[model samples]
Target: MKSTPLACAFAALFFPVIASAEAEPSGVRTNTARLMTTDAAEVIDAPVLGLQRTAIPLFAGLAVDTSLYADALLAPNLGLRWALAAGPHRVVLGARYTHFVGASTYSGIVESEAPAIQSFEPELSGPSFYGVYGLVLGPIQLQGEARYGHYTTDYLSFTGGAGFNFAGHWSVVAEAGVRVEGGSAFRAAAGIRYGGEGLGFGLGAAYVDLSDPALPGESLPVLPVLDLSWTFR
Candidate 1:
């Protein structure tokens, strides 16, 4: 999914600050990061059949007086990350794979619905490589990273974000970027991280907005993303 301007703001607000004071946590040198998540959604209210022609169609039928349609979506992921420490800076890199499962079906229809309620089970996965430069000052840590990758359907994307570390173990991260291949779009994301030794975990979401490739002028959008990972020694 892609991110919106608002998502970036939330990540920035929640992270990049210190709430507690304590000694820097040890074991920040090993694997350093990991994440995972599962999700489901339902869509309703339509006079016709088949995928909606525009992004706005997703919310067109959410009122109290519309017919209801239900669909299930699942996204499962896995990742690994490592750091190469330098004198005053550190480099962080990683990769991820995501699968979108389940399907969208139309139920409760009594008569012929042209095209009928169909099923869509699409999957997106690829390698994401990134670099982060880190600096330590007193009890605060600051860093920046850039990433680029292509998914299974020949979709390419590039992203970059910054983060802050508190006492070395806990951190907040935010990213703003874009995706382009045949078409172009924008994205934003944010999350929290807990890392030590060869283990780490994170939670966050992203949103995306762009034109509908299957339709003209219309837009297709995805939102409310959750990301998770794990690092091995």
Candidate 2:
């Protein structure tokens, strides 16, 4: 069958293969690295593994990255992250004010998990700040982050991850994080990431224990790790 030009154009416009000129993998890349930007900065969403984020460049050596996925209940959140310019061999430094918030600001009564009733309202928005550091190698990226915040609960978590670009626009990524303060919580995931000049996607399976963290042999949540983003350079 002969394909029409219109069909080809439509496919090209929306289904182009994902690829990027930069490291593309998630990490705190150095300023000296190719296409270096805070676009790789860590957000509170998936922590070490990050999630959908947008980095608005504010200066030559700094950019602010924020994400809304950090809060599962859509609680009012504010996250600020800065990527301090550094060389590829040096650590890229930055910080977050808080994560972003979306809707759910009204006050009302809600149901609890125990079949209990409860009321909800916005509080004085707690303090949430984080320090991020990352380094980029040609096809390898590494990052570490620590965050302190309290929304429904208080936590201080440390996370570190590594990514290896094994093929064009494809990378193998793994991350592990733990909350040492407030309570014992743990998360670890290994997945693949895809990136184009602007769009990116991530998928993997993760183990998340929010209360007393213990590894369950075969009982794992499906689709625990998922990320999708379209960034504007």
Best by lDDT: 2
After superposition on all C-alphas, the RMSD of every candidate to the true structure, in Å, is 19.0, 11.5
Off by over 4 Å in 2: 1-51, 70-73, 90-113, 116-124, 211-223
Write down the lDDT that model 1 would get: 0.41
lDDT (Cα, 0-100) at 136 in candidate 2: 68
Model 1: weakest 10-residue lDDT segment is: 35-44
Q: Tens digits of per-residue lDDT for model 2 on 1-233?
A: 98899998977876644445243544422111211111243322212223545445555445555554655546434444444535664344544454334334433322232233344434435666666566767678777767677665778888777777777677777777887876546766777777644556776776664432322243434345567665543
Each model's TM-score?
0.43, 0.60
Best by TM-score: 2
TM-score of 2: 0.60
Candidate 2, which ten residues in sequence have the lowest lDDT sum? 29-38
